[model samples]
Target: MSSITLYSLDGCPFCEKVHDALDDADIAYETEWVEPLHSDRNEVKRVSGQRAVPVLVNENSGVMMAESDKIVQYVEQSLA
Candidate 1:
């Protein structure tokens, strides 16, 4: 089993969308909540080069990306 990391923020609609997609696809993922000063949002930004919510990090495949559509597509493809 590979590991998937999702960087999200509470109450973010985009992040919620991604969460639903993951559940629908039956994909298991670890999540990191990005808050103003509560967590390491900068680390995610540093790695992805963009401080965007719902960043999906596929550690197994060494892929990191933002955007809900792309994230869902990547997840589907990776699982397949």
Candidate 2:
């Protein structure tokens, strides 16, 4: 099973960038849509310490990070 999990939100440009990067690299990953409020927000905060989009968690490598540019670069370097 793939160990990549992306925490993102719809209509977010940052998240979209990460998505494109993943697709460009043909890396299979699971997505967790972090909604704006309540439960979803809590989940993101719990994992990343901030309620933000474009969070990438690579369990296989023990990498859990937040930031679109970094996430894209990491994905490209690790899988592309």
Candidate 3:
């Protein structure tokens, strides 16, 4: 499994979905919590070039992506 860092916001269901998937796969990952404001997503934008919750960055493989379902699938296939 690659080194994973998730940029997420609290109270976001989409982010929670990724969290659940990672936990179920037993993938150890770090979280960088971003504020729920549009401007506060600069960090996410810097990494993924998008302002979206549940961005997953695989530092080892250099796979940076956004979207909850895709992140879940990546965790299952790559990490599992």
Candidate 4:
């Protein structure tokens, strides 16, 4: 199992951005596709306290956060 997990939604630009960053950095991560409706994203909310896509959870480092730019920066500075 990968140490990182990305909560994402298909066709979401922000989610794609995070995915691309992880791919470019060659970081192996598991993708958990969330619901299309915000109300249905309970798992995301449970983890990050929000229903936002592109939320990343690094189990090994015990880091959980949202936002694409932040996640990309983290990948470059830490994971990559």
Write model 3 residue lDDT over 20-70, tens digit each, in one string: 999988888999999889787898888888887889999889898888999
Off by over 4 Å in 3: none
Candidate 2 lDDT, 36-61, residue by residue in tens: 66455988788789897889988888
Best by lDDT: 4
State candidate 2's TM-score: 0.90
lDDT of each: 0.82, 0.87, 0.89, 0.94
lDDT of 3: 0.89
Count of clashes, each model: 0, 0, 0, 0
Candidate ranking under TM-score, highest first, comes to: 4, 3, 2, 1
Clashes of 1: 0
Candidate 1 residue runs with Cα over 4 Å from true position: 36-40
Off by over 4 Å in 2: 38-40
Error at 35, model 3, angstroms: 0.8
**What is candidate 3's CA lDDT for residue 11?**
88
Per-residue lDDT for 1-80 in model 1, tens only? Answer: 54888998889898999888888888888888887553457877877887778898888788889998898787677763
Residue 18's lDDT within candidate 1 is 89
Candidate 2, run of 10 with poorest lDDT: 34-43
